[model samples]
Target: MLIENMKMAFSAIRINKMRSFLTMLGIIIGIGSVISIVSIGDTMRTMFADLYKEVGLTQAYISIGYWLDDVRQSDYFTLDDLERVKEVFGDEIAYIDSQSYVSADALYGRAKVKFDFQGIDYNYQDVQPVNIIYGRYLNEGDVKGRRKNVVMDVKSALQLFGVENAVGRTFRTTIYGSTDEYTVVGVYKKDLSPFQAMMMGQSDGGSAFIPYTLLTWPNDYFYAMRVYAKDDVNLDDFFGRLKVFIGRLKMRDAEDYYMATAVEEMGMMDSMMGGLSAAVGGIAAISLLVGGIGIMNIMLVSVTERTREIGIRKSLGARTKDIMIQFLTESALLSACGGMIGILLGSGLVSAVGAVLGVTAVVRPSVVLLAVGFSALVGIFFGMYPASKAAKKDPIEALRYE
Candidate 1:
C-alpha cells in the first residue's frame, strides 16, 4: 500500500514537472545555505585546532599590567626574576624568555632601511620557533656573551643588503642613543597563517631578532615573559601557581599579574566561532520557513486540480486515511529530493571555499542527517492543511467539479 501511494505521488509530480521544481526551490536553497555555513564553521574550528597544536598547547604568556596608574617600573619583572622562575620551576618549565622589541633604521653603506628588532633569549625559539633558511639561530653563547648578532627575515635582508642571505654581513643601528653595528648571523622566512594574513596589514619595515641582553631599555625591565611548560604538565595548574610565585617575587597580589595560555585562547576562539556560526545559521533558516509556505501553497493547488481524481479514488473504496497519507507522502518526497540536491550543492561550495582558505572542510554526518530530517518535517507540517482539505471533500461534490 505504501509503495502504491509513493508511485501515485511520483506520477502526479511528473505530470507538472516545472511546478514541482519551483515548489522544491525553497527547500533546496534553505538546506544548502545552512549546510554551507555549518561545514565552514566546522572547518575553521579544525584549522584552529591544528594551528594551536603547531604552536604547542603547553605555551603561556605572563605580563605586568602597567596600565594601572600606580604601576611602577619596579613592578616589571626583571632579569633576576626570570632566572628565579627557572630555578624554582625548573622541572615543570620547558623553556622561558623575556620578549622586547626596538624600532630602528638599519644603515648598510648608502642605504638606510627601517627594521624592528625583536629581543629574545636563546630559549625563545624553543617556545616559539622560527624557520631559518641560512646560518643558525641564537645560541646560549650569544645570549651569555651579549653578542650583537641578529637573525632577520629574507624580506628585511633584501631591503637592507639587496640579498636574501645576509649572513656574515653587518648593519649599523642606534640603540638607547648609542650607535653600534650589528651583524646578521642568520636569515629566516616569514610564515603567517591565512587568517593572520587577512587581519594584518603592511608594516613600515620588516622584523629581525636579537639577543635580549643587548636591548637595555630604561634599565632593562621587561613587562612580559613567554614560557612553555613540559608536555606532561597541566598548563592551567602550572600557570596558576607560577602567577602566585611571580606575585610573591614582586611583593604584589596575584591579581596584579596577567597570564594567557594557548588552551584558554583556543577555547575562547571556539566559543566565539560557534556563536557567530549559530547567529548566521539562524538568519539563513528564515528562508526554510518561506520554502515551507511555498510547499503548502503548491499542495493546495495540486489538490484542487486533482479533485476529480480524488473523487474517483474515493468511489473505488479508498478510505480518507488513504487519501491523507498519499498527499502527505508526496509532499515529503518533494522536500526530501530537494534536501538531497541541496547537500550536493553545499558540498561543492565547501570544497571551493576550503581550497582558497587552505583548510580542510569538515561536514559532519550528524549535521547532514539533521538537515534532511528537518526538511521532511517541514513538508509534513506545512502539508497538513492541504492534505486534510483534500481528504474531507464530499465524494458527490468532488465528482461534480470540472
Candidate 2:
C-alpha cells in the first residue's frame, strides 16, 4: 500500500513538477548552507594539527616563568631555576630548552619580523617540531663558544637577502646590541601559521633562530624559557609543579607573572568553538522550519486542488487513514528529494570554497545522513496540520467543491 501511494505521489509531483520544485527551493538552500559552513570547521582542525607537526616541535613546549626581569623586583626564572626544574622534574618531563627574544622587533629592511633572534639551548629542535629543510639547526657548541650563527626561513631569507640560497651569507644585524655580522648558515621552510600579518603571533615565524647565548654577549640576559614536555599530561603536571616553584621564586602570591599553558588554552578554544559552532548551526537549522512550512503550504494547496478526486476515493470506500497516508507520503518525498539535492550542492560548495581558501574539504557522511533524516522529520512536523485537515474533510462537502 505504501509503494502504491509512493507511485501516486511521484505522478502527482510529475504533473506539477514546476510547483513542486519551487516549493523545495527553501529547504535546499537552508540545508545546503548549514552543511557547507560547518564543513570549514572540520578543515581548520586538520590545518592546526599539521602546523604543529611542521614547527619541528612537540605539543607541550613548557616554560612557566618570566625569561628575565630587568628590574630589581625580579619575578622571573634564571638558569639556576631552569636547572632546578630539570633536576627535579627531568624524569617526568621532557627536555628543557632556554630561550631569549630580542628586546625590539628586528627589521631586515622594510619587512619587520616580530620574533626576536631567539636564543635557545642545544636540544631545542628535538623538543619542538621545527624542520631544518635547507641548513642545520643550532648546536650546543655554538652557545658555549658564543658563535654568531643565524638560521632563517625561505621568506625571511628572501626578505633580507632577496634570494633563496642565503646560507653562508653574512649581514650586520642590530639584534643584540652593537651591530655585528652573523653568518646565515642554513635556510628553512617555515611552518604554516594562520596569523600571517602577525606571522609569529603564535610563534616567531619570520625571525631567525640562533644559539642560546649567540644573540647576546652574555647568555644571562635571555628573555623567555621554553620547556617541551614528553607528552600531554606530563607537561600539564610539570606546569602545575612549576607554578609552585614560580611562586617560591617570585617571593609573593602565585599570580605575580602570568602562567599560560598552550594545551589548556587550546582545549578551551576547542570546547568554546564547539559550542559556538553548535549555536550557529542551531540558528541556521531554524531555516529548515521555514522550508517545512513552505512544503506544508504547497502540499495543502495540492490536496485542495485534488479535492474532487479525494471525495471520489472516499465514495469508493477509501479509509481516512489511507488518504492521510498518501498525502503525508507525498509531503515526505518532496522533502527527501530536496535534502538529497542539498547534500550534493553543499558538498560541491564546500569543495570549491576549500580550494579557494587553500584548505581541504571535509565532508562528514553523518552530516549528509542527518540532513536527509531531518528533512523527513520536517515533512512530518509541518504536514501534520494539512494532513489532519485533508483527513477530516467530509466526502459530500469535498464533492460539492467541484
On a 0 to 1 TM-score scale, where does candidate 2 land against the true structure?
0.84
Residue 299 of model 2, lDDT score: 86
In the range 1-402, model 1's lDDT, one tens digit per residue, is: 999988988988888899989998999998988899999999888888877877778888888765566888878877788899999999999987775778889899998988888888887777677889999898889988989999998998999899999999998999878899899899988677675445343366868889987875567787788788999998778999999998999988887888889899999999999999999888768888888899999999999998998899899988899999999988988887777778888888998898898666867889899889988898888888899999998999999989
- Which residues of candidate 1, in runs, are more than 4 Å off? 1-3, 110-113, 175-178, 190-193, 196-205
Clash count (model 2, backbone only): 10
Query: Candidate 2: where is the Cα deviation over 4 Å?
Result: 49-73, 98-100, 103-116, 133-135, 190-206, 214-223
The whole-model C-alpha lDDT of candidate 1 against the native structure comes to 0.86
